[model samples]
Target: MALVKVFSGSEILAQSLKVRIEAAGVNVIVKNNIQSSNMAGFGSLGQAVEVFIEDKDKEKAAQAIEDFKMGN
Candidate 1:
């Protein structure tokens, strides 16, 4: 299955999103994991973490994230 980027944020936030999406039965992968370790620059502690899921599950994954953000 093809993967599509759904969100991007800090490592912690990406991991949190991953857990939530997976809990909803949607598989997720985190990209740029190495970038999360480098805090050399100012305001760069979070780094760039990309979250991806199957293309077919894009809508559901997005809704899950929205619901999560809405505290649903």
Candidate 2:
């Protein structure tokens, strides 16, 4: 199964998105999470968190992300 990038953002937002996507039955992998974990004061502001999902589930993942953005 090919993986596709669904979202990229701050660690907190990425984690939140991960949870939402998983709840929708889509698998998620997070990149740069370790980097965010090691960030110190003022270091996290520039750190990026990336979220990936199976290519087939991209649409569902995107919907979940958009719903999260809309506070749904």
Listed in order, each prediction's TM-score against the native is 0.69, 0.73
User: lDDT for each of the candidates?
Assistant: 0.78, 0.82
Candidate 1 worst ten-residue window by lDDT: 36-45
RMSD of 1: 3.6
Model 2: residues with Cα > 4 Å off, grouped in runs: 33-47
Candidate 1, residues 1-72, lDDT tens digits: the string is: 898987787777788888899988998888865554454443443457888899999877777899767767
Candidate 1 colliding pairs: none
lDDT of 1: 0.78
Query: Which candidate ranks first by lDDT, i.e. highest?
Result: 2
lDDT of 2 by residue, 1-72 (tens): 998877778778889989999998899999985575566434454547888899998777777888988988
Off by over 4 Å in 1: 33-47
N/CA/C clash count, model 2: 0
